[model samples]
Target: MRKIIMLLCLLLFLTAAYSYPQSIQAYTAPLTADEQHVLEQSLSIHEIDREIARIESQQNETERSISELSEQLEGKNEQIKDIREQAGARLRAYYMGEREDLLAALLSVGSLRDFISVLDYYELIMDRDRTVLNNYKTEYADLKKTKTKLESVSAELTQIKTNLQLQRNRVAALQEQVDTTLGHSTDPEKLMAMIEELTKYWENIGLYEVRRYFRALSTAMSDFSDFLDDHKDSLVSEKGGYRLEVREEDINAFLRDKNERLQDVSFEFGQDKIIVHGSREGLRLEVEGHYTVENEPENSITFHVDRLFINGFELPDTTRKELEEDFDLGFYPKKIVPFVEATEVDIAQGTLTVKLKLSF
Candidate 1:
């Protein structure tokens, strides 16, 4: 007990001036997406199909948008024409002969009340023309803007179709190459099996990613715990626990300080789970997991994979389960054990809160 107290005192003395990250900073992800990297690394039939399907989906949506915009543009043009004609008719009526009749009617009024009524009627006619012109101006402006956007959308659809055609050409080229190399003797079933096997291989990689992410979390929590020890007074006391809350940004700060390779890595703490995403070396990966703390003999944090996505494609459930079972990325905040143990870890949006109990 005396030696344990001496160690704790020495640790506090050594870390008393340590400062936790207080300001938020962002580290930009790499420009190239992981999907592109995968394609570059292995130009397989599966990748080509995935690319084609994506472009085709975009093509269909663009066509629908163009159809809708065409209808709207037609209606707007008709509306502007009607408003312009109405306003023009009123102007022409006054210019041709109505002005003289209106002046004569005002002059012939028998009393002040009659004169006032005639003036009110003239004013009403002018206001109606003015309102019509305003409506025309507004609608005409909108019509022009819509026409411009339609042109851009049409161009986009053209590009999408062009890309689809290019993919078609690519598929033909790859198929021809394979046939030539294999003397057209390779079994069709074998080729298909190869694609399936390749996909399964990629899925296994998801487990590696899950392990890497969990390890990162472990190191981040360990660093944060060290900081917490220096400022234990700031912990909020609840009915049966003491809680420490932190933002993803601060966690990021700690990670960044630990390794320059972690520049693009970022985290999101959600309810009962965490989302990690980043791009590096022309690859992007995202993983989410629900974490639980263990305190049977030693306090440590561990998690089970809920979802894993690489380049926007989610890993299969079989792969996710494998990820959950594979590695131990548990974080043990050994320094804090002498004072308190973490009991409940909760997440909300961008914040992480760890509830603790005094370790007696």
Candidate 2:
């Protein structure tokens, strides 16, 4: 009887050890080579889009500068032309017996005062002619400099246009490659139609749901940790374990406040499932969930959590709930609600699916 009791005690201890909740961990799922390639390509496409936009913006700025320079050159040329005309008139007047003309004007004066006024007027005309000649030389020099600068600017503009064209062509080629890889047709019209169909499908299906959840999940976990740390004394239960009750709004606030944190988590989207992997506090957690669209009035979608592993250990429902409560798991769906018109959640087959009606 003593041996039997000892055996039972050992068995119970083993069971308890296996069932005990461990620390919150980050997760990673197994991926095939093809899936990995597809994910990489998708990320590359986003980067390519950014590059194309940057190049296009630079091209526009260059074109605007070129136009303004061209206008300035035109104005400079006009000024040069007017100066040249004035200089030419002054030269013709000087060569056309200017001295004889001045002498005749002095003889025609009626009095000594009129003669003195005529002499002053002759000196002013000669000085004005000299000023005009100086201005003409300056204008010619400026015109030459402006033309040189204009030529240089034109060359730069041409080079920028060529680069812009190359970027566009590269974008087109990448788009083509993406289309082919996704089994889309190379024809423009057909590709557009496919895109439309895919857009509709994405909207109606649960693609974005997984994305939003994981994003919110990461933030909620981080916030929950901080909350626990801040209120560590109060959060401690009688058993010396921590228990936290997190509402949906709390998670939503963290997610909205720190949306950029979503980039820290990795997401792998497949036709039927989404695999999310992230690390927090030295522990890795992975969640694999599948979703289906519901034809209800609310456009409800259901995501079924297929598997959840923390540090390679499968999480049971009881422990998972404990982790959720401790880590504020319910807040993830709440974070997604504001972006969508409405949201509903259903849990089945060890999975949670959130159906969302997008506002936009």
Candidate 3:
């Protein structure tokens, strides 16, 4: 039953994701061009500084809010305590005499009106007591909400700072190596070795690459959507479901560009997603889906999307980790970097192509 309920919730969530205006695409390439290389280095530094400053400011604000909320809650408790203390003192004085004596004192009032006034005052005290308790309750509820929000924001900022810090360290180390290598006279062997080392470092630092790749893929998805809008009637059937047909040649180009082995591969539009089922080398990834949704294309369009599932099974563990980190880091995953960006996109004979390696 738990599994069923969870599955229902997941379905609802995916339906919403599908309904949003977004697109998903994947590509990979080695960095080329001296300008691009320089920019990547500069971008890495800028990203690190921006992220650090952002994380620090956000965490400080969240911490301050939590502290303020704590003090306010404590103040409410003090107010309740004072009310209780006053009530206790009143009870102590009235109850000092025996029950009969206390009744006689009340009966010895100056007049019926005076007795009635005393009763009304006692009722007023009781009302004040109830109001104080309710105030405490209300303050507690507000505090809980504030604290929860603070924790979430703080955790997110901390994680982002940590991730950015890691990237910053990596870039700094690489920058040092680059500077040292450049300082020396031109040596092809040393340059080659440096390149190899950098490549290995990039692969090991999986999160950074994953972040950039997804950003590029997202931009491509948007361009693909614009292409679709121009040819929407061609893809959408009268039955309401969409069909995007890609020829084998198109798949071949994708494989050549991405360096994916194409044996045991298939492509088609599956339900509300683009399905890419193939074995890359011997990894045997199957049942991958891609889709594009039209958000406002008037100015700059924004897309919110997910890869959904991979292979015939589910997405690999790394994908989930990246997403969780993104949440914890308080980074807007795609908006800051689209998965794909293109100056000009052209489709020929059912093959989709775009200019690659754009700077954000």
Candidate 4:
């Protein structure tokens, strides 16, 4: 009876061990030379796109500043013109002897008191005219200096814009070459591997949002899946997924989508406030608000924004409502939901952190 009981206990332990799910490790396949080249080119294209966006934003702000300065300069020119006209009129009156009435009155003065009073009044008027003329000269000189400085700044901005455009064109040409090379290949797995490699590279850079990164990944994968359907015989089953050939056009399309939607937005946490800053439609948007994350139904996490600002201008109640209606707050964890039972997003000390519970 003791031996039979011990055997039963061993059987129970074995059954329990076998019933537990085994850990699944993420697998990354090796990249061929061509695949590595494609990834490098894709990364380059993305980096260049970001650079172009930054340059364009700077250029826009510079142009706006130049416009303001030009307006001020025009006002100053008009003021100077009016001052010169007044001075010219005074000169013409003095030179043409239009002050004969003052001379005649001075000569007609019979009493010593009258003569002295008339002389003092004439001196006072002359001094006042001289002071006004000196002020006009000073103001004219200052305005000229300001105009020169503004013109110099505008010229510098123009040069910078030119250089940025040239750089963009060169990078775009290189990206085109890469796309042409990729277009000839019909292998979907190789394309998918390139995508994975590109994602890993971006992760190492450490400036991208995981959610946005995954969305891009999903888009690339979906595109590739369609391509695979067209050429099913060449499709290779891989661990994560197959790589879709990323073209320069694809990168441009992705950038356009990102720009249309708000890109480069990041949140920083403080003692009791969260600060958000980024550009939207070439204008800077900032927000200082209380941040909260709530778990919604169907494994969604909603990040709530209590307040928002665009270009330092606070949105009105109606505009805020419109913003809330247009922008999505719920981030769906597509790739992470499989491995994570629960997910939480938190902000602390200027960093946004994500906490995950593993299903294991």
Please give, for residues 1-360, the per-residue lDDT of candidate 4 as tens digits.
999999999998555333321110112225466665665565556556666776788888888888988888888888888888777777777888866777788879999999999989877877877877886888789798879979898998988799688758867886776777668668856675655544443433212232333244334433332432444433232344321222323333443444434235544566556665665222345656553444555554444556654323243333333334444443443343354432455545544344445443
lDDT of 4 at 168: 85
Task: Give per-residue CA lDDT, model 1, range 148-263, as digits (tens).
Answer: 99999999999999989987777777656655544443454544443344354443443344456556655555565565555555468777657767677776776776656567
Model 2: how far is 300 from its true place, Å? 60
Q: Please state the error at residue 186 of candidate 1 in Å.
A: 11
Best-fitting candidate, measured by TM-score?
A: 1
Where in model 3 is the C-alpha error above 4 Å?
1-39, 70-77, 83-126, 184-360
Ranking by lDDT: 1, 4, 2, 3
TM per candidate comes to 0.46, 0.38, 0.37, 0.43
> Which candidate, 3 or 4, would have the higher lDDT against the true structure?
4
Q: Would you give me the overall lDDT of model 4?
A: 0.55
Separately for all candidates shown, the number of backbone clashes (residues 3 or more apart, or on different chains) is 0, 15, 14, 3
Candidate with top lDDT is 1
**Per-model lDDT:** 0.65, 0.53, 0.44, 0.55
lDDT of 2 at 295: 43
Poorest lDDT segment (10 consecutive residues) of candidate 3: 20-29
Which stretches of model 2 miss by more than 4 angstroms?
1-33, 95-119, 184-360
* Tens digits of lDDT, candidate 2, 80-121: 888989999888877898767887988899999999999898
